[model samples]
Target: MPFFRWARIWVLSLSGLVLTGSIAAAAVPQDMQDFNHYTFAVMWHPGVCATWSNAGPACKDLSPAAKINQEWTMHGLWASRPRSLLAAGMNGPTWWHYGCYWYNPEHALPKGSCANPPLNLPEALHQRLYAHMPMAQICLDRHEYYKHVVCFGETPEQFFPKELDLLDKLNASAFTAFIRDHRGQWVARNAIMKAFADSFQVKNADALELRCENPSHHIHELERQGNILTQAWITIHKDKVDAFPAPESLEKGRKGNCAEKIHILN
Candidate 1:
């Protein structure tokens, strides 16, 4: 389980990176025409685990399971058990504070095609693994809503069509305040945000606005928020409720956690 232990340590370290300035701010990839479409390809239709080893788990299979686990963790369920400890009353500041520990390190490892060019690099394999680790801070809350992870260029509202009404209702004054309060949270909870910021070229404020414009652009923001709330609620009301980790949580850690794992993966 050294790998698992390594994964845990790596994930924690990444969180620190986000807090610091190890990752640079960047915009969403230009090639990514639509966040939903890109996400679908990554989450549901990954053509192959394009890795040099070509021996890791199949991306199609690995990702679906991982996706489910992510959903579970978003809704809390820090660990994989019949009954969640959160449901029994786990006292913690935030459900996501220690949620990355429950991820399945094996799945988080990169499994790509053996012929990829990046593999030629000395640390390509590790880099690829680090890229896929699903380490983030926000999970699904009790309401089955997910918070918006800051995508590279767009605000959360811009990503989601459903949020147009919400955005419209939000005056400039409220919007500014909201952004100030939640920007850090979005960056902290979203691996894509970290990756975009670190790997791409953009300003942090621009990235936050991009995500806010359409939260659904990156992932299902509502789902993310719901997952976080659910996990937190379960942790607070574990004695009176019974919940399980979303399948996604079991597969990959959140953005911060994933970034940490990537550092170690290399």
Candidate 2:
């Protein structure tokens, strides 16, 4: 399966890093390791492809016939548009892997607005600086363009005073509190879960249970343990099992990974 292949490489590389002292070698929390393993299995496994007949609803929705074909049109537009970095001669896949498929750059928050600033540098400068950054899986979702107008690191007051004013008009603190309280339910409703599940060919509900019920599933336990730093690392760099938003609202803050992206959709 694709997942096994990825896992083999991942494990081998991690081992090498440990041996070489390139990464601090320590036993990851058991739950975290389990979560990572499960995510790896689901995201990379070809079994999902087989189970879903390669035309899972996520892919199906991207087809020409679906109601959401318009969304795919937007995706295609993003794909075809010229990005600043690539030159005329370099015509290859420009999208980066996030969640399940290639992340269309247009769909991504502009590099200038993404979490990292240096990545948003001028094309020539970016080329020189990021030559060695590892290409790994990432997540992509539809974002509210206005919400991200300010650069990611900047204070809201600095870059988007007007937007912040709008947020204030809407009872920003109340909205944030509500999201914090009910985000999971929204994610369960959103198409992201379906995409996550389809990518992994697993039921979203079952996946959650698997993580929670299996003691060997260390990652779930660690998340439950509330180790903030470890959880943050796992969410940001490894996978975001905790970020799944509530299904009822389309709001952000969904616990996700490549697999959950498909599961929530179904």
lDDT (tens digit, per residue) of candidate 2 on 1-266: 33323323322221122211111223211221221111211111111222333223333222333322211001000112122213322233432222111122223333321223222234653332222111111111112111221111222122223222322322223322332333223133235334434433344523321111111123333323321110000111122322322222112222433222122111
lDDT of model 1 at position 231: 15
Q: Write the per-residue lDDT of candidate 1 for residues 45-67, one digit (tens) a residue.
A: 12112221231333324443343
* Candidate 1 least-lDDT 10 residues: 36-45
Compared with the true structure, the alpha-carbon lDDT of candidate 1 equals: 0.23
TM-score top scorer: 2
Model 2 poorest 10 in a row by lDDT:
70-79
Q: Residue 190 error for model 2, in Å?
A: 3.2
Q: For each predicted model, how many residue pairs clash, with residues at least 3 apart or on different chains?
A: 92, 47
